[model samples]
Target: MTHRLPVRVYYEDTDMGGIVYYANYLKYIERSRSTLVGELGLDQKKMKDEDAIVFVVVRVEADYLRPARLDDELEIVTTHHAASPMRWVFDQDVMRGDELLFRAKVTAVCMTTEGKPVRLPAELRAKLT
Candidate 1:
């Protein structure tokens, strides 16, 4: 399944050339990840209070395709690619209408507040159903 969220390129998200900044693509991916977790009924506060765990991006590999200009309405698409006992992997893409602006593969690991890797909590694992 695919998850999508809409985003508008704002002035603050651009570089001097009025094109969306390279690093801002990662921000959009992050937002989509947040939405994905929220839709799964998992959030930071609940994770902290119940499982004492949090998911953090351990790695990301991205490719810049076309450029997006300020004021362009974009959609961020994310797919849950794989999951293991302790980690999740996703394929994400940023698109301006039908044009691909950027794409990435992100690996996130479940970890405790102290940064120790942990098994995916039962609640999160259950939600994958």
Candidate 2:
């Protein structure tokens, strides 16, 4: 399944050239992932508090395909791609209408507050798959 969320480019998200900053694409995907997980019934805050587990991004591979300008209406689409016992990988994309602006493969690992890796909860994995 794919989860999508709309984002409008603000002045702050643009560079001096008025194009969306390179780094902001990461932020957009982050928000999209959060919403996707939440929609799957995984409450991050609750997981941290109750399960003592937190998800941390360990890797990201992205490509900038096209440029998005200020006030552009963009959509972020996120989908679960793969997972192991302790890590998950998601594929995400940012688009403006039919044009693909950016895409990324994000990998996150479950860890304890103390920083030790932990196994991902079965429920969360099931939901993602």
lDDT of each: 0.89, 0.90
Number of residue pairs clashing in candidate 1, backbone atoms closer than 3 angstroms, sequence gap of 3 or more or interchain: 0
Against the true structure, what is each candidate's TM-score? 0.93, 0.94
What lDDT score is found at residue 49 in candidate 2? 95
- Name every residue pair that clashes in candidate 2: none
Per-residue lDDT of model 2, residues 5-115, tens digit only? 999999999999999999999999999988887877888999899988898999999999999999999999887754788888889999999899999999999999889
Return the lDDT, model 1, position 93: 95
lDDT of 2 at 32: 94
Give residue 69's lDDT in candidate 1 (0 to 100): 94
Query: Who wins the TM-score comparison?
Result: 2
lDDT of 1 by residue, 19-120 (tens): 999899999999999999898777778888787888889999999999999999999999984478888888999988888889999999888988899987
